[model samples]
Target chain A: MKNIFTGRDIVSDKGYITKRNIIEKSLQLFSVKGYYNTSISDILAATNLTKGGLYGHFASKADIWQAVYDEAVCIWRERVFSGVRDRTDPMIRITKFIENDLRNYLGADVFEGGCFFLNMLVELSGQSDPMSKQILRGFVRISKLIQAWLDQAADQGLLKPGLNHKEIANFIVISLNGAAALYTSTRDDTIVDQTIEQLGFYVRQLKA
Target chain B: MKNIFTGRDIVSDKGYITKRNIIEKSLQLFSVKGYYNTSISDILAATNLTKGGLYGHFASKADIWQAVYDEAVCIWRERVFSGVRDRTDPMIRITKFIENDLRNYLGADVFEGGCFFLNMLVELSGQSDPMSKQILRGFVRISKLIQAWLDQAADQGLLKPGLNHKEIANFIVISLNGAAALYTSTRDDTIVDQTIEQLGFYVRQLKA
Candidate 1:
């Protein structure tokens, strides 16, 4: 296909492409060395870009950090939410969602660090930054998704009568985060395995 | 009161006192800025120690990290485990243990970066350093404690009849770690409230 756009148009397209590249690379570095530890120089080095090139796309180091956070949220929503969207059975859908999540997390090119949410949560919790607000919005979004999933499960009779969807949703979110924390810290799949098993047991208990 | 040993003994006591101060200050800095982000100069600035004086105690930056980890583990054991040592009722003891844990973790001074276990877990998980090994050991030790508590509770008919102690223990640990992760990220007490509520619900299920 012949491209009609040229010059400034191509430059804008390349700008988006370069920004994505920088964000992905920054995510890996930040996950490994953490946000505070990863400097602008580190991001530049990873992207093999000059300071002028980097700043042309991002106003500051904080701007790039926000971009990375946004990309991570996008990937998580697509990978975890989209994977479970088609299933009619709540129990199966939930199980598949957990399975896909573990697979994506573990089947990585590098074990840089843990979940972006958990990493950002710990790193930015006490610091007041633009990125902190983004992290909070991401967390609230995940919790709400879990709540919605549980509510659907209960409505569909996949959950036992009188089960508390809100409580169970909170438990699922907390336990999954915990499992991710443990897995990232230990780099052991067993923690993930145990979490999966325990989650399965909890879900099975919801059956009438 | 007159000390029994003078001169050398007093000097030794002073040495111990200074070392404790170094470790305490190092913990705060590392917890705040993390391991790689913290430099020897940062420690010196925080403690007002000259290079020679710091070298007199810790051999390197890694040595200081190890000391911080050890001190954190020591305090964690004393605060969380000591309360559960003598209780015969597993359910009651576990509940008390969780409550004590929440209190310690949610305290204003200690609540900044969440639990040290979690901080190190994310910070040190992929590294091949001795400190990483120590971090792993601490994780195993904490998980085993939960396992033991669950086993005891199950034996005494304190847990739901069909529950597996190992699985439940894993769930409890994961949930606790997850709560810490959330609290660390959000720096909000709502996560702690959710954790306490979840633990209470689980405990009730365990009780006959």
Candidate 2:
């Protein structure tokens, strides 16, 4: 899992811990302050690391950003699929995924800014760069995951045979992203509660 | 209405035109590049204005952001409400508002990024600042507008008497913001087309 990272020559335990610490601090900064909004100084301030000390671990701000972003995605994946990843039932897995997304991913409060990926998706989508393309690919991947679940459900004779899986998957993605953006800003519970309930109903209605 | 803006002491036509020109140029930069990503240098490069010339028109980058953002909202409001703003039929107004939102507002391609407000909503909502509050307030205002239309439909005997207007309005806002975010990045027409059709069906299903 590459949980341990260090300079090539410095494989000391302290160096590995320092590198991980830098990533953890920078994740909070990037999640809330955003990519461009977060300055190198912010990371330094948050991590209490000098430029030399910080650079000893990462090459530059971009290097730290990549490390932080990767870690955030790891946390998000673990949270969103904690209990349901190993489930046997496709329908129950789908339900648990949505529940984990609402109560665990967006509701985890791990990052100060709520869902790190969605915030990045929103911010990066505005810019034209490889990162923007990366964010879109991430959305497509999640959509595909949901579609696979729906297909499995259909195979299990639970979902309708003629329903469009891609459309439904995209719709679910939109709803979850909307709920995160709206709930994070408004701090309104109904946004999350209603979305969870409505989406459950939407998926259940697709049953054969 | 505020097509013309002038400095307190300089009401010259050249100053008025230059200020408007700056606003127009900055709007494009902020729309696609985002609030924090767009630097004063980018704005200057786009406008070909000296630092002095740019500062003469607006007090600071924050001032320029406010001007640029306000102009974007003005354009958005006009685009979303152009045909049905004064329409007498509440149901038709609701339908047209959704249509305009999908085809006219999000689909207008007025801003380089897509929906200016939605992008800002996603970006600024990540940062805890006055701008975030303003963005949430803007969402609420839109929700209230939709709720008013729903209420009007109910008053006119066109909608169910006991439907929850606030939830529906909030759901519509979430859907539109989601649609704009998804469509802008993916450039997928189905995001908008499906939203328009789904929302229309959703509203129609509320009949008395």
Q: DockQ for all models, in order?
A: 0.60, 0.48
lDDT per residue (tens digit) for residues B26-45 in model 1: 89877777777779999999
Q: Write the per-residue lDDT of candidate 2 for residues A104-198, one digit (tens) a residue.
A: 87876778887777777777775646776776787889889988998898888998678778887887788788788887776677887777766
Residue-wise C-alpha lDDT for candidate 2, range B52-122, written one tens digit per residue = 99888788888887887788879888888888878998888888988898888777688887777777777
* Candidate topping DockQ: 1
The native-contact fractions of the candidates, in order shown, are 0.69, 0.51
Q: DockQ for candidate 1, please give it.
A: 0.60
State the displacement of the C-alpha of residue A40, model 2, in Å, after optimal TM-score superposition: 2.3
Measured as a fraction from 0 to 1, the native contacts recovered by model 1 come to: 0.69
Residue A8, model 1: Cα distance from true site in angstroms: 10
Interface RMSD of 1: 1.9
Residue B35 CA error for candidate 1 (Å)?
Answer: 1.6
